[model samples]
Target: MLLNHNQSSLSFHSELYSFVPEDHILRRVHDLVDFSFINDLVKESYCVYYGRPANEPELLFRLLFLQFLYNLSDERVIEDSQYNLAYKWFLGLNPEDSLPDSSQLSRFRVHRLGANRVEKVLEHIVKQCVEKGLIQSKALIIDSTHTLANAAKGKPLDVLKKAANRLLKGVKKQYSSLYKKLPMFPKLEGADEEKAKQLLQYLVELRNLLEDKLPDAEGSLLEKINTVKQIIEDERLLTNKGIASAVDPDARFGRKSNSRTFYGFKNHIAMTEEEIITAIHVTPGNEDDGKQLQTLVNKTREQQITIDEVFADTAYSRKENLTFLQTDEIKASIPLNPAVYGTREDDKFQYDKENDEVICPAGHTSIRKAKTGRTGTGTNPCLTFYFDTNICKQCPFKDGCYNNTKEKTYSISIKSEEHIHQMAYLDSDEYLQRKGLRSNIEHKNAELKNAHRMTRAKYRGQFGMRIQAFLTAFVVNVKRMIKLEMAHSE
Candidate 1:
């Protein structure tokens, strides 16, 4: 069973070979990258000389890859491998080969190819594309997308109390002695629910009592109780933990600008200038997008891809990110946040950095210039300009721009010189070209959500979400490399 002995060879009577066209994407994917790398990546996860053999690791992983490649669920992919000739050809199955049950794919993913190997397998496939000249990697386009969590946003107070009590009863078999002495949690129902405040306080107390009594308890039990305790502490309405899924408590409430909000995870991606995704990372929903640029940059270097420029939207325009990219000698094409620049209109004043002074709107220059070194925490200080308000009071624009100041000479601070210099290219033709390329990542995000089934996670928990992202990106790269190859041929 482990050896996959049902493979078919060239035959005069068979039409399987002619069924698929030469221009098919799967054929291109198969011929482009070697699947042999999977066997090496997952060999240690399997039993070498075992009792009743198991599904071959390579075939199983290929089936999972097929699911991601075409956006099929586990059942659909297995069904396709059984009846679809193109799928059969891709899986190297004989005409009468039996499809494994759908349950097998789930078990293999959770048990066989855990998070580590899943990541490494993706990297190995990327290396193949690099050798074939499909990915240039000279520039990286960065962005993030949200995936909704499987759990509900809020559970009623009574509902949560019952759920928690049920979990405690289920665990009683392991700690019979400890369970008997534990305090019975108060069960509050009905209109007293608005006393949800009291309910939270009670849960926190119960959690502390349980931990104090069972000091040496398994970490998992402690974690469940702790999750409930933290939920009580974080939310006034007492929605599960800060996470939406109690079972998958790692997912968080992610904020996307001021308009959209969802409970789930965020996928941060770094794509090559050619549009192939080179790296991806998953973070809690509420995490800041600005924090992951350095991490994505690090992943590219680990794969030996040199990143000469990184372009991102305003969400990733924090000072630290700009400084890091600058220190690394990679061009940081981040736009300035509106908060960084005050009420200065376009061409309101021209700044001469070499002379260390600014000309006001009325055509008079500032009286003095001041600057400070980097803070102990390492962020660049804003450059402050001192304006003589006595002169400003006589100017036409003073009523609109300078009324907020107290000094006869008003002082204004703007973001660092480096940030201003980097943002100066906002109007260049070259900048617009590159920015257009950055927006193309939105199409890729759509493809993942629409074509690859990333809209809602198929499995629960953070690691499961990561597996889904990695495999989806791998399949996408395979398809893209083929398209690029075909276009070149044409």
Candidate 2:
């Protein structure tokens, strides 16, 4: 049950908090933010009239806030708060009052706030910033950073074996009698591929057995069953781009650059010029950065924050995105990707925007074009323009440009009038200045990883990653708001 929100009476020990200076960061944060809303946000998740008196949701939330603010683990945060006077004062606990057990932090995080409500934590914080007039700029910057998965990448066979063993163990542990009725682990005496098929078949049988016997299994057993189902249904299990770990099935392989890759999740973020984060979109590592632009924009707009301009890298320069900004009448300072505009050696080919065709160096225009390749894959989808080889065969430029190829084609990965207009805007002084503003978000990303320990996930699975990301964003935003407030006062 959620306890009452009555203020605790001051005790003799409470006076000891006087030693914590009024100018302390936590003190400033406590004054800046009215954390009482936390209680309301988590009220429904708690039992109102049943169970023993539970810790106040606000208090538990404060502990979590302190935990992320200091970059401490669950145990360490509770332990440190017990002795740290400033922490005690920030938590609004009497000096002698004992803290709730560290484990409560996880229970509260997983059950109370959870994935559904965690996002509200960030949204509420951003709302507070807007209310205070801390976020004044109409321009928002968008970017994404990677968080390494807690689980290591494993081979397909190893992943299958591990998942099966986990399911079997969970069944035995939870329902011993049911375990005995289930089929034993399948014997393997063949090549890796053959053994994998046998193990997969056994897992399917095992799932059917459990579903029949324990039709209402919940918690870890249900989770394990679901995990096994995922492993079974994944057709790309044997491929490199497939599930790499049963422990973190949500994570996928994503590239940091052409030479560097990371296996984990991405924290796609949108921030104001004030450096306060307005929205966060978490996805598997392999998710496209460009796809999240609309999500981030809509999320920011949800807060009633007017977004007249967006600053981002070339990844956000897709033709669709340019059109999106244009329709909304929002200014976009994103750099154009050469792939979208189609580059050439010494400008041998030029796009004729009016006719929607490419002009060869010899002034030969393309006849027809076809869009090829699947979008949202790692590869860039292109519009391939087929030129008549009949004209190329008799042209002087045929030797180097056309040769004797069956099809004389010029391909541009992306094309639109929006892109053409964007290309022209890219050279303007306004675009150049705003382009540099996007780099400021890079520092914020670094601070999140280096200072808050968001470089690697602290918990397993996508849910855990979302919890980590939003909470960290909350801490960072709170700190930034405090700084902004301080500056305003001076």
Candidate 3:
């Protein structure tokens, strides 16, 4: 039955206007996330204490969560929330209320929930997952991707020299015009006009020197001088770009495909079998995955979670990483680079597992000669092998075996005793299952890049980028937790 016109002016506060009504997904998020946990982890003292006192502590936090969940910049979030009904409903905001201004959000981010606070939030979520038995910490997949910084390309020396010359000429003309207007301008009491003249003269001299020497300077010295000259002439220092991020110094330039390069910091995450992130590290974009493996493993250990196996690619297959993982009883299922195995010159080369030797195609056995050791790189001892020179000299496969004039020597580095064992396990069904689990971490990366819009950070500088990364990770964990809770309830 349709209601009569205007419903006879008998409208009450209908449930229709009560957006979300505790049944929406966002409402479910409010239920799954223990606000007390976030409060405990992120201290109130860090936030703005003097702002309009609000009884709802969740207001500030929800704003941050919205940034990550939607991957919107601070300004964009405020703009959208002010006009968007869905956003207001999602954030538990009433229709009458508008979002906080961009400055307020920025201040809140910089002061209250900074990078450290965001990390604590992420840790708390991980802790919740751990307690819920949703994270199987025994197996982990570790990887890193480069993030580009917001720095600009440096200017050329010739351009700087030309610009400096133009500026010096203009300054001279301006000084002449001012002096003409006031005949005693130079004589003004306590006036540093002389100092200004001296500085200008020095600048002119310096510009002349630069113009003369720029063509002769070689290597990085030339680059350094040119950069300085550009800064002086342009009144602007060199930066990757104006976008300051707070994460790492060595932001790397990375290519995701044939044409796109991501400029920022590398985000390293170790995901467990249950697809929960066990550990996360925001490092310089240039940091290698192999170098970070041990540190991440240690961090996982710090959480009181034992990492029994690590799945990664060839990049983390360095000897040092393997040795460290082995000592910690962590199995690393890193794929071997086919190049490392070397190609068989002839079909006769066979590897011997029992005697730890290699049999040459010419029927000559290559025996272990000396155990060479490498420090700093890894604790693994490299076993050197040499074929009998007498046998090699007359062998039918001599040409194929010996590239050098001397006796043929073949060396293989055994990083761990467990390498052979793990290699065997890598072929087993259990290892395959772990590999399957490892593939899921890429989905998390995709979510960050595609869904969360983390591919290019809006902020510039290491610290800013770190804060952004932490917030993004925190949002991901919250979303996962909320989904898990909903599934459990169902």
Candidate 4:
């Protein structure tokens, strides 16, 4: 049933203050947060004199915020608003007020506040937290968790079949002559695997024939052809039954670890030890966590928060990342990948930077030393040190040190100052003490998944996931701020 959103016809009489508890969570949050700033944050999103009569901007935002705060679905949020007294009071509505349409929230996110604008909402709220002293940006904990896409592990052939049929209708509309020449769109729904494969190949043939006529086709049309190309033409498409989503092509197969895998995106987050989220960045499931460390820290900095220390798991360790953190004076609590180094005994070798020589395992030193793989810009370059083969070949423990190969010599080479700092940090008590704080982000990630609906993504594609992620961070941060406010009030 369609909801009647006509505000003029609704009754306005209600004693909501008497109905709600003095210390209600939502009520306290409502009192603590000055949502009036939201008007300015979203002012440009609204047109002064266009479109039909719309719901109030504050009303839309409050209801949308409630979704992640309570982990309610679109239909569930609207339904709860009608019966839930707290929700009614939060929205400033009387008991008999007409609820906004459920679908309207979806439309509002896509049209009114897109991914970019919603990001602004999260940042603005986080800035408020910073100003109120609820969260400090001196140290940040970073982590990534997988959110399953709104798609299934459907067979690649079945995925291609849908894309092909959608393209068939388009070709019939745009180029009738070519459409007639192509084979008729085959029916493959619920068909046997062999039958589906045959039909899929036929569609591929038709698409190839059309490529000569219109080489620049895109959108759903181009997606349809690529769907087939990814399945047949690509060698590594899905040999192990790996398949990308047909609806949300941006989502890829991601793994929790070597043992577990899920098809969706990774939500990389930065938070303080107080468990308050500062920023969020979502990437395809298979994206490397280390690559996004700087991006996440930069996001927090954009809100005027300074990140002096970073805590993350081993996945976020890279030579470049360690160099970046050390150079910026931000202490990194990330453990370097042992694979980045040589054998256990080889770690005993020390560097003498002054003479540009490496002391070998048997007290022998390399005569020739060369710098390899310099990182960062000039004036502050971090150079990697490599020793010559002549000194390494004559070592008593050469078999154990060099692993009997020319490549192993370079692989085991000492990475100047950056590696030294990382090793010293690993041996320090501060790394052990601060390393526990990294788990704070894991708890935060769990809250997003277990309490919030981040276990499975709601909206599709990168833009859609971005909208959901920013809103999730926004809702979580608000909750954290209120909790901190209550604690401080006590």
Candidate 5:
């Protein structure tokens, strides 16, 4: 239950905030930003007439703001807020007011402002900047950064054993009777593959037993059961990149470059040239960066920011993305991905955009076309056009052109008119100038990792990573808003 009042009641020691400095960052943040919306944002998570009156959502949210702002742990943030006058003032607490336990921070993050609501935290702050006329840039720079998983990557057998142990541990802690009724883990002596299979079968039986005994299990117990189910269902657990760690099943192996790799997740972000982030989308490490462009753009537009230009690297230069930008009339400063637009090596084959077909030098048009190869896997997919082999067989120029095979085909790397136009724009002075704007996002990524502890996952799983990401973004945006407002005054 939420209280229908603010928590900033005056106290006998209220004057302690005077020494917190007139221009303290927290004081400026308190004065400039309105955090009252948090109460409404998380209102649905609480019961109106059940249980004890809950801690004020706004106050709890302020603790999260302080946590990400200073990169402090939940315990540290709560401990500091207990006595720090500025923190107390920023949280709308009178001096000497008691703080909710540090554990409440995790509860609030998971139950109150969950993944569905965390995005709103970033969105709300961005809308505030827009409302204040501080985010005036028409260009949105986009990029992605990596965060290492909290759990270490493990082999399939090790992962299976770890998951089994955790489920048993949770059941033992929460339901000791159920623990005895559950199947005991068996010892096996065999090859790793055989051992993994045995462990997997054991987990399958254990899950079945739990389902029968606890039909309505929820909370951490439910999560453990679900994790076991995922592990059991993954057919390629031994052969492919599936479930590296039972602790973090959602994280995957992603390549940072041709030779470098990391085990974790990705934070796809869109920001204004003003250096304020407008949108953030977190995905598994191996997820494609280009696919998130549309989502980021839509989220940024949702904040009422007029976006006329977008800046990104070659990773975002897919033909589909370019077409979307063309349809929306948004200027794209992204460089062409060489895999999408390779050199026109063979002048004999010309592409016809309007017909969406390629013409051979002999004036014969392709009959059917098919795309080959997986996208976003550091591979070049080709749009191959098949021709009537009879036509090629009878052509006078068939000597060296058509190999005497069962079929005749000509292939061109995916070449769209939007890509052609973008390629042309890539050489212009304006494109080069606007391209430099994307570098600031790299610095923003650095700040998130270096200054805000976003370099590694603080908690396990994607939801935890997302919670960390949005809260971190929220803190940086508020700081950026302060700087922008101050500059406008100067």
Candidate 6:
């Protein structure tokens, strides 16, 4: 067969595709990140898996890096790989090979990027940043943001019960239809019947009560009660579906915004002066930020890095936390709550250094109560002071001193001697020099939120959200490393 070819359509090319050099900044970043170190840390024997043996492992790894570096969604990443030459070069993709599907990317994220893997990758990035002189390991700013989970806005118990009853009625109709088709169908009676009836009845009652109580319930009480009722109804709904979970529960709610209570987790991050993410934590949504700080700090310590100072907001300013930081040889620079510092009532209780006693406003010195106490890890020694009941009761400022209580309260408190010492150290010019560097992490936070789109998490569940956060931090560190390298080249 003879065919006439159009010269314009059949034009010959010198090469399969013209190659462009990788960006200098991206190349420098690749050198600084140390992919092997990250692989060793994040890629576990059970966690790592390959679908097609021909697929390059490095390419997959780089895909995760891109997630944070560019803050691209899974679909966007696929589109970029197909259309954008820069993204193609970054992922080390050849000109002929087609980009991976979005679903494959999603599966890879879920099956391979578990909590431990994400943490390990983050630690490696932080270590690299420290080695490159990009991150200051000694000083750190720790903060947590609430990541909303993928759960629905739960309805009140009464409303949910009504809905469940409606569902049950539909299920019964289907069951009856099936029973008619099969003459020998098992009877849907006994415990199952009683359970169904009881659940339906309770739901109806709950719905009625909620409608009545909603108008009268004051402040947050109504919302709280409504949430509680919704949780109960949800549990019942799940039970009807013959489902149970030892881990995932309806009680789990997002911490990001209480208004958007969802089933997921919280992400806590510790950032260094060089904008490297030193540590990250993914916990249940209901977990308190105050409880996670010490654990995160401990984890950072385990990396063989000494933290000199820990900066946080008022949530971490409790006496227990202050004492913990002092004992750990780490300085905690948390601001006092306005109520605690602004009020002059506490000024009366002055510390008497000579006697280790607390002097009340009435010129009465209180003696020490306990010398030691036990914390989460071990015993902690502390000095406590208390005022005499007789003196406190007859004082003219007794109401201000004792909250108008007849008990004439005796309080036991741990005086942070090390905290006072640290405070003195912080007040020095040299310490102030280091403390001034803490503001850098704020800019880093802003970059992650605004530039990297970390202001809101893209994934649902604690594990997925954490992976996203880790990737964001990893990308931030890489960018910092790239900038540092460029500065050095200059």
lDDT by residue (107-216, candidate 2, tens digit) is: 99999899989999999999999899999899999999999999999888888899988998998898888788888787897998888788878888988888888889
Model 4: residues with Cα > 4 Å off, grouped in runs: 1-12, 168-183, 186-243, 345-413
lDDT of 1 by residue, 125-172 (tens): 778878888786598889999888766655546535644674477457
TM-score, ranked from best to worst:
2, 5, 1, 4, 3, 6
TM-score of 4: 0.76
The parts of candidate 5 lying over 4 Å away from their true place are 344-414
Winner on lDDT between 1 and 4 is 4
Clashes of each: 2, 0, 31, 0, 0, 1
TM-score, each model? 0.79, 0.90, 0.66, 0.76, 0.86, 0.63
lDDT of each: 0.74, 0.89, 0.61, 0.75, 0.89, 0.58
Model 2 TM-score, all chains together? 0.90
Winning model by TM-score: 2
Model 6 stretches astray by more than 4 angstroms = 1-28, 36-54, 155-265, 336-434
Q: Which prediction has more favorable lDDT, 1 or 2?
A: 2
Model 5 lDDT tens row, 1-490: 7777778777888888888998999989998999989999999888899878889998899999999898889899999999888898888888878999999899999999999899998889988888888987899999999999999999999999999999999999999987888877899779999999999999999999999888999998999999999989988688758889998998989989999999999999999999999999999899989999999999999889999999999888877888889899999999886555644555577888899988888999999999976765434578888999999999998888898899887776755577778878888998876677789999999999999988899988999999999999999999888988999999
lDDT of 5: 0.89
Error of 5 at 90 (Å): 1.5
Question: Which pairs of residues clash in candidate 1, taking residues 3 or more apart in a chain or in different chains?
Answer: 254-285, 389-408
How would you encode candidate 3's per-residue C-alpha lDDT over 394-467 as one tens digit per residue?
77767755765665776666545545555676678876765766677788888877888777665665667778
Error of 4 at 135 (Å): 2.0
Q: List the candidate 3 regions with Cα displacement exceeding 4 Å.
A: 1-17, 21-23, 40-57, 89-93, 153-249, 254-263, 304-306, 336-373, 379-410
